[model samples]
Target: MPAYGLRSHAWPVTHAVTELIAVNAALTPGRELYLSLRHRDSALRIVVWDQHPRHADPDTRALCEARRSTALWLLAAVVDDWGGEWGSGEARPPQQGVKSWVLLPQ
Candidate 1:
């Protein structure tokens, strides 16, 4: 995907990368993931899409977390330190997947 208006800030970049990894891990073996970056509403928005419409079950998520505590911790740290917002939900429109996104102040 094409990227635009991305900044060089370390925390946002780190958060984005970690989020991408999380999305990739959540995808089924043969499925694909999509990414989008944009500047909007005075913030930088980063989104990652995966083929699953619903989030993984708690047990599954916990299993993944156990294997990826560092990256997930870093992602959480950045969002908490920077006061940014992040979430995942059903994708819009005819899309058949989930969109995980982060909005960091510019």
Candidate 2:
């Protein structure tokens, strides 16, 4: 995996990423970061999760077909921070497929 770039509290977003990595690593040994694209370059996919799954946008409610708010903005921020085009996808649990994506520009 690429090294965690910049280390400055001024960049809360970057610092948050580092903290998330550390927490995940501590919580789940060998599973530090949720996404790892060491294999190759390709389009990306992202599936966010939350306990409550409904939304103010009736359209999104229909689109996601979810239960509570899924923090879509936060998801986008993460993807943008990581330099990738963002898109939505359904996540079927109890064997939901993978949870990472690649967004190669056209």
Candidate 3:
């Protein structure tokens, strides 16, 4: 992916996924895709924010998976159930959650 060439396929969201991609593409050296997202749960409300959208239409997500899995599952993964082997055991540390999951028939 070229730095100057990403403006065409770039998708702008609340936080700048495109800018991150551009910066990574320009500064980093590899053919990998980078994804960033945030999910927050407050006393009253829950918020989910993502950067790259599944479809270019930007209307609906084909799956309920979060942004990391969505990018992996849709763009870079060789297999359908990519990134599925990440351990979801109870051994997760204090700061990080063990794993994320989706429980629906897609």
Q: What TM-score does each of the candidates earn?
A: 0.65, 0.30, 0.24
* TM-score between model 1 and native: 0.65
Clashing pairs in 1: none
| Error at 43, model 2, angstroms | 7.9
lDDT of 1 by residue, 4-93 (tens): 444455557665767665645555457887778777776777787767634469887655445434545566667767778776566787
Q: Which ten residues in a row have the lowest lDDT in candidate 3?
A: 42-51
Supply candidate 3's per-residue lDDT for 86: 22
For each candidate, the alpha-carbon lDDT, in order, equals 0.64, 0.37, 0.28
In the predicted model 3, the residue pairs found to clash are none
Q: Candidate 2: global Cα-lDDT? A: 0.37
* Local accuracy of candidate 2 as per-residue lDDT tens digits, 4-59: 33233224334334433443344335432344322233332222222323356888
List the candidate numbers ranked by TM-score, top first: 1, 2, 3
Error of 3 at 17 (Å): 0.8
Query: Per-residue CA lDDT of candidate 3, range 1-106, in tens?
Result: 1243423222222123343354334322454442434232311111222222234343333232343444433222222232212211111343221122221111
